[model samples]
Each structure stands twice: as structure tokens, then as C-alpha cells.
Target: MNTRGFYDELADRYDLMYADWDASTTRQGRALDALLTTSLGPGPHTVLDDACGIGTQAVGLARLGHRVTGTDLSPRAAARAAREAAARDLALPVAAADMRALPFADASFDAVVCADNALPHLLTAEDVRAALAETRRVLRPGGLLLLSTRPYTALRRIRPTSEAPHVHNGPDGRTITFQLWHWHPDGERYDVELFQLLPSGGTWTTHTSGATYWALPEEETARYLREAGFGEPVLHLPAATGFHQPVLGARRPVPHTRSTL
Candidate 1:
């Protein structure tokens, strides 16, 4: 299925992957806040969540008082994010846009975030570079860029097939979710099948979705960040950040010139 269709199928139920999804937004938001503050500074800064999905991070960041705008390839997902924000009485401007090509002015934001393993969705080096270039273009000079993805360094060798099932209560009843990963021969790409067993009246119903991602390692990702105009890219492991995935923190370099006699 196409990216938009695949996410559209999963949008309404996406948050069920987490236990207490709302609380997770706050936790992830605070974690990102600490990272942003430690590197960028303490204050209300403008942020763009380029691959916002259903606005989990965007809403949380908005609650934290950061001017946040979000975009996603799936129109349904973007709309859902807007509704989610509104439900919380937060104003989060979410638009439908591809990460590879953003529709925003240059240097318009203090930070650009592509969290929740969003970067890997681009399966090729060129595609990743294009998205990174756009992300850097939207950030002000010396602005921060944060991205999160699975620890492919170790995950690559393991080639994990699935994750533990996450069960959550839905409007009608309970929902059980899990994913099965199918690795490509190249070892750098994987096709994932997301399955959900949802409650329907007295019986359970099964729904499935598909997606592909590049198993881009930390070293290669950092190199791509530099190629895309970010400097001093640093890899932060989950153990250190208390996040589920490793996050890469980098910044746009401020232009400087030496005085001549």
C-alpha cells in the first residue's frame, strides 16, 4: 500500500500502541524539552515536527508552550493531529506535507524535530538527504535538529522480527497490537506488517498495515546530517536519554568570519 493509505488505515488506532498514550506524549515532550533546552537554551522556541504522525510530540511540545507546527504525509494523520490538539485546548497547526519537500520559509524555526523513528521511513540515501536538507533549511542559524530511530547498529545484527504485543482499551473494548518485520536481502531495508486485533461487538476483528524503512545506522545517519549542512552531530543512546530509541542531536552552524588587517 502507499504511504498515505497505509497511515490512513492506522491513524485512528495509532495511539493504541502505547500504554496511556496521552501520558506518553508528556513524557516524550519533556524528554525532548530537556534535550532542546540543554543544547538550544531555555525559552519558548518555534518548532516544526516534520514527520509528526498523529501529533503525539507536537501536542506535548505545544503544551510546553513552544510554538509548534506539524506536518505529515497522511492528510488523515495531519487532521487527526489537529483534532487531538484541539481536544486538549492547544493550538497546533498541522498540515499535510512530505518531509522531503516542506512548504515553509527558510530559517523560520528554532528547531526541527523528526522523532518516533520517522527518519528511517525514507529508504534511500538521497531521499534521506533531501528530507535532511529541508529540515536544515527550515531551522534558524545555530538552531537544533533532533531525530530518533531504532539502534540499527545492534538491531541490524539481530534482525528482530516482532515486538511485544501492546494492549489498550478502546472506545468499544480492548485492542491488541503488534508488528512483524520482513527483512530485505540487502539487510538495510525491512517491510513491516502491523497487525491489530480489535474488539468488535462480542467478537474480535483483525486489521493489518504495511510499511518499509531503511535500517540506517548511526554512523551513516550522522554522515548524512553533515552532508545536509548540520554540524557536530551527536548520537544519544536511549540509556542516556531515557527514550525508547537513540536520538541524533545536531545543529545548524552559525556563520562567522575572521577580521582581516
Candidate 2:
């Protein structure tokens, strides 16, 4: 399946990927908020979760008092995000939008977050640049951009074919999730098959979804950020940031004003 179709199909089951969705949201939010605060300052700042799926980060950030807006490429996922936020009584405005072309005025937000390895789905350098340019355009001068992605450095080296499964037991039953990776010969792109084994009456049912990604490591992503007009980008690993994935941060540089003639 394509990216949108894959996410759309997985929207309802997305939470199943997490052992405890609610707790994951809170933990991720705390880490992201701390990272942002340390990089920028304390905020109730206007923020955008550009690739928000089922309101994970957006809802958590909103709960922590930031004014957050969420957008996703999948309409179903966006709708699910909105509903999830509403269910928690949080005000998160969500819409279906492509990251390469956001529907907002220029310099509209204090920060933009494209987390959870979303950018690699672009699959090509040109597409990645377009999205980064759009993200930079939406940020006010000196505004922050937070991006999280898988550890592509080692993946490029080892080329693991499959990920370890995560099994979760809830009140209803048990579910197991894992991924299979098929790398292209070029060594920079791969197709992912996400498999979820769900409990059924007397039997287990398997559901599968697929998408492609480019193996974009920190150095390459930072280069794209700079090319798209952001300031020098910094990489934060999970060990240092307490985040689940590697996070990169960059800022839009403030323009210099000329002295009076």
C-alpha cells in the first residue's frame, strides 16, 4: 500500500502498536516538551504537529498547555486524531494536509514537529526538501523545528530484515506487532511491511500494511534543513533526549535589518 493508504488502514489500529497508548503519549510529550524548552524557552507556544497520527504527540502537548494544531496526510488518520483529542477534552485543531504544502499563512507558528520518522516517507531528496521548505515557511523567525526519525545509520550498515515483535495484553485480549523490511539494491530505500497479529474468537487474525522510506541519517537530514533555509541543525539521540527516536532540531534565522541611510 501507499503511505496514505497504509496509514488510513492502520488508523483504527494505530494505538495497538503501543503497549499503553496513553502513557506513551505522556512520556513522549514530556520528552519533546523538555527538548523544545531547552532549545527555545518555556512555552505555551503555538505549535504544529505536521504528521500527527491519532493525536499522539499533539494531544499530549495540548494537555501540557501548548496551543497545538495537527495535520496528517491521511484523512482518516487526521479525523481519528481530532476525535481522539476531543475525547480527551483537549482543543487540538486537526486537518488532512500534505507536509510539502501546508495550508497556512507564512510564519504561522512558533514550532513545527514532524516526529515518528515521518519525513523518510518522502522517499526522495527533492520531496524531503519540499517538505522542509514548507515547514520553514510556516515557522516564525527563530522558530524551532523538531523532527524525529529511526536510527538509519546502523540500519544502513546492518540492513536488518525484520524487527523484534512486541506483544501486549489488554483487558480484551492479546496483540502482537512487528515489521519486515525489504531493502532496495540502492541501499538507501526500503519497503516496510507492518504486521499485527490480533486476537479473534478461537484464532488469531493477521493484518498487514506497507509503505516505503528513505534511509535518511542525521547528517543527510541536517543538510536538507540547511538547504531549506534553517539554521544549523542539531541531532539528539534517545540516550541524551529521553525521546523514543532520534530528534533533530533547527531554527529559522532572523533576518537582519539594514541601518538607516
Candidate 3:
């Protein structure tokens, strides 16, 4: 499946990927809010979640009082995010959009968040650069940009075939989520088959989705951030940030103004 199809198929069940979806959202929100505050230092900044899949980060950030707007390639996912936000009495406007070409004005936001291993979905250096360029264009001068992805450095070495299954026991009994990876010969890209199995009477119901991703290491992503006109690109490991994945933080540089003689 393609990117949009993968997410669209998984929209309603996306939260099932988390053992405790609500708790995970809150925890992730807190961690990300702290990161944003530490970097920007203020209240209620305008933020854009460029790859907001079902509002995983956007909803949490919105709850923290940031004015957040979200966009996703999957219309169903974006719609689900809006519904999720509304259910919480939060105003999180979301649209279906591609990160490579955001549907917003220039300098439209104070911060842009591309979390949850989203950027790697581009699968090519040029595509990644285009997305970053769009991210930079939408941010105000010195606007913060944060992105998260798996630790590709280690994964590239190990090239694991599958991920450990995540088990969640809820009102509906038990559900298991896991992924099987098929790496390309290049070692830099892979196709993922995401599977979720749920209890159904005596049998189990299985749902699967697929997508391709480039194993974008922090060093490579940081280089793209710089080449896209962002400055001070820094990688924050999960050990330091308490986040699940490595977070890369950068800022759109303030354009230098020439003084008249």
C-alpha cells in the first residue's frame, strides 16, 4: 500500500498501536511541550503538525494550550483527528495535505512539528528536502521545527526483520500490534507491514497495512534541515528527552537585514 492508503486504512485503529492511548498521548504531550518551551520559552504559540496522523501529537499539543493546526496525507486520518479534537472540546483544525506542499501561507506558524517517524515516509533525499523546504517556508523567522523518527543508526546495522509485538488489554479483551520489515537492497529503505490482531469470539480478526520508508538517520535528516535553510539542527536522543524516538530540533534562520550606509 501507499502512504495515504496505509494511514487511511489504519485511521480508526491507529490508537490501538498504543497500549494505553490516552495515557501515551498525555505523556508524549508533556514531553513535547517541555521541549517546545525549553526552546521557544512562551505560552500558546501557533503550531502546525505537518504530518499529524489522527492527531497523535496535535491533539496533545492542543490540550497543552498551543494553537495547533494539523494536516495529513490521509483525509480519513485528518478527519479523525478533527473529530478527536472536537470530542475533547478543543479547536484543532485539520486538513488533508502533503508535507512537501503545505496548504498555508508563508511564515504562517511559530513552530512546525513533523513527529511520529513521518519524514522518513518520503523515501528519497530530494523528497525529504522538498518537505523540509515547505516546513521552513511555513514557519516564521526563527521558528522551531521538531521531527521524530526511529533510531536508524542502530536499525541499519541490525536490520531487524520484525518488531516486538505490543499487547494491549482493554474493554474489547486483547489486541496485539506488530510490524514486519522487508529491507531493500540499498539498506536505506524498507517496506513495513503493520499488523493488528484483535480478539473476536473464538477467533482473531487481523488487519494489515503497508508503507515504505527511508531509514533516515539523524545526521542525514539534520543535514537536510540545514540545506533547507534551517539553523542549529540538533538531535535529542530518547535517553535525554524521554521520548520514544530520537527528536531532531532545528530553527528557521532569521534573515539578515542589511543596514543602509
Q: Candidate 2, which ten residues in sequence have the lowest lDDT sum?
A: 165-174
TM-score of 2: 0.98
**CA RMSD (A), model 2:** 0.9
User: Model 2 clash pairs?
Assistant: none
Off by over 4 Å in 3: none
lDDT by residue for model 1 (208-227), tens: 99999899889989999999
Please report the candidate that would top lDDT against the real structure.
2
User: What's the CA RMSD for each of the models?
Assistant: 1.2, 0.9, 0.9
**Local distance difference test values of all predictions, in order:** 0.90, 0.93, 0.91
Q: After superposition, how far is residue 117 of candidate 3 from its true place, in Å?
A: 0.4
The order by descending lDDT is 2, 3, 1
Error at 190, model 2, angstroms: 0.6
Better of 2 and 3 by lDDT: 2
Per residue, candidate 3 scores C-alpha lDDT tens digits across 1-261 of 899999999999998888888778778887789889998997688999998889988889999999999999999999999999999999999999999999999999999999999998997788998999999999999899999999998899999999999988878788999999999999999999999999998679999889999997778888888888899788888888888999999998888999999
Tell me the tens digit of each residue's lDDT in model 2 across 1-261.
899999999999999988999888898888889987887789888999999989889988998999999999999999999998888999999889999999999999999999998999998788999999999999999999999999998889999999999877777698999999999999999999999999998688999989999998789889999999999999898999888999999999999999997
Error of 2 at 186 (Å): 0.4
